[model samples]
Target: MARRRASNEELAGLVQGEQTDAVRRLEDRVAARVLGDLESRFAVLSQRSITAWVAAFGSVQAESGDTAALRRILSTIRGAVRRLLGPLGPRAQRELDQALTDAVLLGARQHAAFVEEATGRATRPVSGRPSRGLRRRAAAIGAAIADRRDRALAILRPSRARRWSDVQAGIGAAQSALPATRAHIATTVNEAVNEASLTAIDHQGAQKLWIAERDACVNCAAYSGMVVAADADFPAGLSWDPNQRGRGKALAAPPKHPHCRCRVTAWEEGWAPEGVPSFPDSLRREARRSIARGWSLPTESGAARIRAARELLRTGAGLPKSVEEFAALAVRAGRFTDRTVPTGP
Candidate 1:
């Protein structure tokens, strides 16, 4: 007996899963390079600052020091920050460019393999150059890092400083830059894949479908499994309403918002995979459930969450008991959008 061959769906799942893993690994690599460099630089700066201050003021923990000496030390640290960290943007851009090239190439390869498997023909190769959208995002993130460093330096500047505690507070404020950089790295990687998918779709003349993670935000959920032509834009406006009455501009691919994990895959008629009820239908159902359950609605905006919860209530759809309770409570008391709301298994 011969071994069984996997169906188109199985093959697609295998390849797509591999691509997802590749994207993650690329993201980790870029982040490690950029962030590890940042951490090391900060560590060196911190150590040198301590050593300098201790040498001049007798101790880094001193409550008060010679005023002119403290000013001079602070000035030196400012110069050091500019000298040591000023190149961060250019360095990060280099990392982003390289990682995006790899990500795009991998996407192109997987997509070509899938197309060949589905239709037994080879498609054109995708360019590995980062798309303009991706470049813009990278530049923005790099600029933000530099801006944060500058702001941190501003805070570290002596303005009638009385204690080392104040210096510590400034450093703490500066550390806020790290989290946003981490999120941006994820966003940039996802966008790179999205760009590649779009290019592959163009090369193969295949339709593309938006794929949202199961626990995706309401906005991303709205696009889950939505199929569109290669040249067409997914309809604009991201709203939680089942009808999706949003006013935002149309999008070309995944990353409906910052830090979005949504993706896209090629779609064609008669290639629907086996063992799933219906991919598009399932995604639509999940979106409905997300709205009804108030899952991932406006984590950053309390007012938006309350509005979304209220809209869900007004839709006349049957909300789960807990969702109804919390939606009502949230509407009654405009708060707690970030609170953990259960998403059913």
Candidate 2:
């Protein structure tokens, strides 16, 4: 007896899983480089300056005046921001260009292999080069990093700080930019991978289905299992009511928002072999589970969580105990009467 060939769903799942891992590994590499750079530069700037300041002024209140020492400290902060974030953009761009190109190429090959297995016909090879659009988007991500750096500088400006405590707090806020940059790069990678994957699907002349992760946000969950022409957009919008908001505008891709890790897979009714289950249906089921759970919503605002819990409860879905208690508190606080739903971006 011959060994059985893997079904299209299985292959597509493996390809998606592998692609996710590749993106994550790339994120780790880029993040590690960034963190290393930040640590080395920040230590030189912060440790020396902080040590000098505390040695000169024994108390935080002693540095409350706009004196020469304070001026020097602010100057140090400006220098620190520049040194820390100046090279981050180009560095990230280099990593994205090389790693994303390879990852997209591998994903394209996997998608092509799926088509070949299903139809027994060799597909045209996909170009491994990152598209001009992807390059432009990656550059935009770099620019975003620069923008964050500027914002951090603004936060640490003299007008914003008086005492050592204020400067320390501002520096704390500025350091948040590092993690934000890492998150932005990771989101960009997902967007790039999906764009390349969809292009590959188009090249293979196949339809595509949106596959939301099992714990995706409500916005992304709404699009799970959506099948569309390779050239067409998925029917639902990224956020808000799918029936009322952005329909037919969102292109078939994984990320409906920042940090979205959705993926796409090829789909054809006839290509699914006998005894193979429905991939789209399985995805939809997972999506429903995500919506019902509602505890894993991405929003951090109490109002947003309460609103989500209310909606889930209205639909007769069970909520986690914490969510129920939160909603109950909002109801008691009379916040629930305010009918405005928080449509997150």
**Model 1: per-residue Cα lDDT over 1-345, one tens digit each:** 223434534543544356566677878888888777666666776777777777876775785557787788777767766765567667777787777778778777766665555555555566657778687877787788788777878877777444666665555545656666777888887888788888878765788888775456656766876888888999998666444466668988877776776777677755544665455555565555555555563554556555666776787536467757766876787765454445332
TM-score list, all predictions = 0.70, 0.75
Off by over 4 Å in 1: 1-18, 40-66, 112-128, 136-141, 159-169, 241-248, 269-277, 292-345
- lDDT by residue for model 2 (128-171), tens: 56778777776775787788778767767777766777777666
**What lDDT does each candidate get?**
0.68, 0.64
TM-score of 2: 0.75
Q: In candidate 1, list every pair of residues with a backbone clash.
A: none
Q: Among these predicted structures, which one has the highest lDDT?
A: 1
TM-score of 1: 0.70
Candidate 2: stretches off by over 4 Å: 1-16, 39-49, 61-63, 113-125, 236-249, 274-277, 294-345
